[model samples]
Target: MKVKIYGEGAEAQELLDKVNNSLEDLGLSDFMEVEVTMDEELKNSLSISKTPALIIEEEAIDFRDTIFEGIVPSDEEVKSMFISIIGGGGESSGGCSSGSCGTCSTGCH
Candidate 1:
C-alpha cells in the first residue's frame, strides 16, 4: 500500500521515522511505502489547511487534529491505522497482535 504523510516542521521527520519503524517492526515494511509531501497547493486541495496533514491513498487519514494537539495514537489505533493508509491484504491474528495494550480498559482491564 502507498501512504503519504504531510507535516512541515521539525517534527515532520520524526513522526515519519516513527511511523516507518512501526510498519517495519510489524513485518509490513515490504508491502508499504511512505512519502513526505510538501506541496502547498496540494495541501490546500486536500482541505488540510494545516500542517501535519496525512493523505493516505487519496483519503485524508489525519489532519491538523493530530498535528497541533501532539496526540499520538494508541498502539491498537496504530495497528488499525493500516486500513486507512494501506489498502490491506494480510490476515490479522484476530486478537491484538501488538500486545502493546496490555493495560487497555476496553474489557480486559
Candidate 2:
C-alpha cells in the first residue's frame, strides 16, 4: 500500500506526522510507502482541490483511493481505514485484529 499526503505548510506536515505515527503504531510502517507533496500537477491529477488531502493507493489492485481532503482525520480513523483496506489482516495477534479496539472501553488486547 502507498500513502500520499498533499499540501504545504504546517498543516500538511502535521498530517504527515500523524500518518507516519499511525503506520508505526499499527506495525505497517515498513509495509507501506509514504510521500508528501505540494506539487500542483500531481494534486490536479488526483482531483485534490483541498490542501492536506490523503490518498491511499494499492497498486496490486490498481487502486488509488482518496481518504480525505481539506481536513484532518482522527488518528484512529486513519488506522481503522488502513486495517479495513488490508482486509483486517493486521499484524496484531490479539482479538482486536477486528480493528474495533478504539471502541473497546478497556482497550485492545
Question: All candidates' lDDT scores?
Answer: 0.52, 0.74
Deviation (Å) of 87 in candidate 1: 8.5
Which ranges of candidate 2 are over 4 A from the true structure?
89-109
Candidate 2 structure quality by residue, lDDT tens digits, 1-109: 8899988888888889889998999899999999997778767778888788888888888887566788776777677666766667554543333535453332321
Q: Give the TM-score of candidate 2.
A: 0.76
Please provide, for model 1 over 1-109, each residue's C-alpha lDDT reduced to its tens digit, 9 standing for 90 to 100: 4556677576666657666877876778887778888877667666665555444453345332122223334444455555333435353443222333242333210
Q: Provide the clashing-pair count of each candidate structure.
A: 0, 0
Best by lDDT: 2
**Alpha carbon lDDT at 105, candidate 2:** 35
Question: Which candidate ranks first by TM-score, i.e. highest?
Answer: 2
